[model samples]
Target chain A: MMDSLAAVLYLILFPGFVFLLVFGLFCEWVDRKVYARLQNRVGPPLFQPFADLIKLLGKEDIIPKNVDSILFQYTPLIAFAAVMTPIIFIPIWSATALFPLQGDLIIALYLLSIPALALFVIGWSSVSLYPLLGGFRAATMLFGYEVPFILACLSCGIIAGSWRISDITAYLEMYPASMLIVIPGFVIALLALEAKLERTPFDIPQAETEIVGGVLTEYSGKKLAVMRLMDDIRMVVGSSLIAAVFLGGFIVSYGSISWAGTDLTNVINFLLYIAKSLMIVFLLAVIRTLFARIRIDQMLDFSWKYLAMGGIFQLFIAVMYIGILHG
Target chain B: MDLLKWARMKSPWICHFNTGGCNACDIEVVAVLTPRFDVERFGVLLKGSPRHADVLVVTGPVTQQSEARLKRVYEQMAEPKFVLAVGVCTCSGGVFHGCYNARGGVDTVIPVDVYIGGCPPRPSEIIDGVVHVLNKIAGGGLAEKSSVNEGQAVQ
Candidate 1:
């Protein structure tokens, strides 16, 4: 009974729904602040995203006529669930996650893709011309990013010789020098993750100037709020996923310090996760600030020509490095 | 104040619309979003979609061509929305006051919550108008919807 209670707490509290929610908003604040500073402007306060969410919650929910009411009402919830489920597998404050299943890396990546699919459904079901166009663009862009992102991530698992994220992290921790071998994979993963998150340069599906918010043009009030939250949490998940695979996920081990019956190492590990994840967020913000939005054709061409080739090359390097280390 | 009201005041996603006046006010409106002015510090984002907007920042004189479009955009906004009329053109139609194509002001079509009047209001003046609306929202002063077609006809 006690074990079950603790399990439920872990799933609902720390490193779970509440924590990810707050952390996701915090990461967004950091992104906005950094993006603002890059442009020599002051950004919104730390509480800005929180305030926006609250305001959105209180606003009227508008569903357009001639749309599938059921799908329109539920797509945001579906995306939110898909984004949140991966948090269980992410090693947050420890080397192992709350639920560590074998081959969980693939599962997490697959789950992450659901939000994009949900977005496509949102655009298509809206039945409006712009949303339909946005939906097609979203699906097109997903094809551009998903292959390279998955390959880049799998290359790290290949190097660590484990399909589980925690094991790959532990392998990197055990052999810190092996970090050098994953640099190409790290760079590839970072860029592909940026595309997956739909930041600038890859934000064609929802480019405000071109498509008036693209897939989100019709969403308003609470539904839009949920969609925004999903995006924010996806940012947190994407960045941390990259951080874990390439940057040695949550370097602190369990029980490193047991002081007066209190294990503070978990706290330390949580802090480390914050630092690494924020670092990834910072890089993402810089990329977002530096690049202009590219056309869809250009995005696809870049993804196919450069990003995919980079992922393949990185995978080859990881394989060759592992062979050298063992053989 | 409650959290919802506080959030509404803090983040006002604005959508800009140009009626049929000269482009000077529009230039100043765009300038307010630039690095020098940077209204984003107050969490005022210039959103493209009316559905995503909490504030409609209307500029230029309301011409016959744009009055209907303006009303449509205003109606599309989610509830608890505010309209901010900037420039003399939006407030009184300015030089286009008696012109055939001009409809006098934004208030002739949809209700306006705030009006910042200048030949072409400075960016600072535009910012002030936004802050005025934010203060009104925080103070629980709901925007008054004026009756449409109240502007005097051009003779």
Candidate 2:
């Protein structure tokens, strides 16, 4: 009973709700700062995201007359919960996750996809024109990206010889040199993940310039705040998943650097994990800032043509390499 | 309550609404968002949806066709919203005053919190106007007026 209680507390406090929320907002600030510097403009202060959240929360929650009240009001919370669930299974400070399971990688993938599904539901339930269009676009983008994203993950699983994320991390720790071979698949997956997060170049679903806030057009007040926070958390989840799979999941014991003793390794590893994920988030922001939003057809064509083909090629290479080595 | 007010003041997302005049004031409003002026430094984002906006930066004199839309947009915004009427046209219809189909100014449609007057106000003036609105939000300028309006409506 004590163990279960402790697990619940850990899930809600340390590596779970509070930690992810704060770290996610920190990552958002870093992204905004880098984006502003890239554009040669003075950006928001460090607490800008937090301030925005507070203001949104303080605003009056408005529900339009044409909408399904129940679904429209509840989906943001569902989306936020969906994104938060995966953080528990991701090994942040150590090889073993707080809620480790044998096939949690597949579970994490499904959980990660829930936010997009929830978004579709939110848009559909609104019964508004822009949101309906945004819902259709989000669904189409999902179809375009999910195939390549899965193939990329499958390639990593094949190379590491395990579907369990903890096992993959262990294998990578044993053979750190294999990260070079995994880079191609990682790059393909990273681009797909960026589209999944709905950033620029692939932000067809929420093209604010054309669709007028897209799926989020009808959301206001606390719902909007929750949605924005969910997006930020999703960014952290995507980056952390990529970092765990490809960058050797929180193994901060670099050669000959024994400055910290064993007791402090957990804290150091946690910071290292956050740093690695922030680096990925920064790269994503730089890519987003450098590119303009692409048309839906152009986005579909690029994803289906280049990214899908690249993912398959990477998968094929991984299969051949693994078969030869095992045989 | 104080923290909420501070947060609202710190990050004021503005939604630009053009009623019916020439495109000059609209262009200037967009210029404030450009890299040169970059109102984002003050945490000002040009929100696409009225639902997400905290401040409505209105341009142009109200036309008969757009007057209702302007009111609807203002009503759609969340509470604690402020309206900044930009350009002389939005303030008092400018040269379009007394023209057929002109509704004079934004205040004829919805209450305005700040007035920025120029044929087409420069981006700097627009920025100053936004800062003034931020002050009003922080210093309770609108609070007193809203209370008075509430009392009058009750009577």
Which candidate leads in lDDT? 1
Q: Where in model 2 is the C-alpha error above 4 Å? A: A249-262, B143-155
lDDT score, residue B21, model 1? 68
Best by DockQ: 1
Model 2, docking class: high
Give the residue spans of candidate 1 off by over 4 A. Answer: A258-262, B143-145, B149-151
DockQ, each predicted model: 0.90, 0.82
- Model 1 per-residue lDDT tens digits across residues A56-128: 9999999988899999999899999999888787787788877889999999999999988998999989988
Error of 2 at A193 (Å): 1.0
Interface RMSD of 1: 0.7
Docking class of 1: high
Calculate model 2's interface RMSD in Å.
Answer: 0.7
Compared with the true structure, what per-residue lDDT tens digits does model 2 show for residues A89-164?
7778777677778788898899999888988998899999999899989988998898888888878888889888
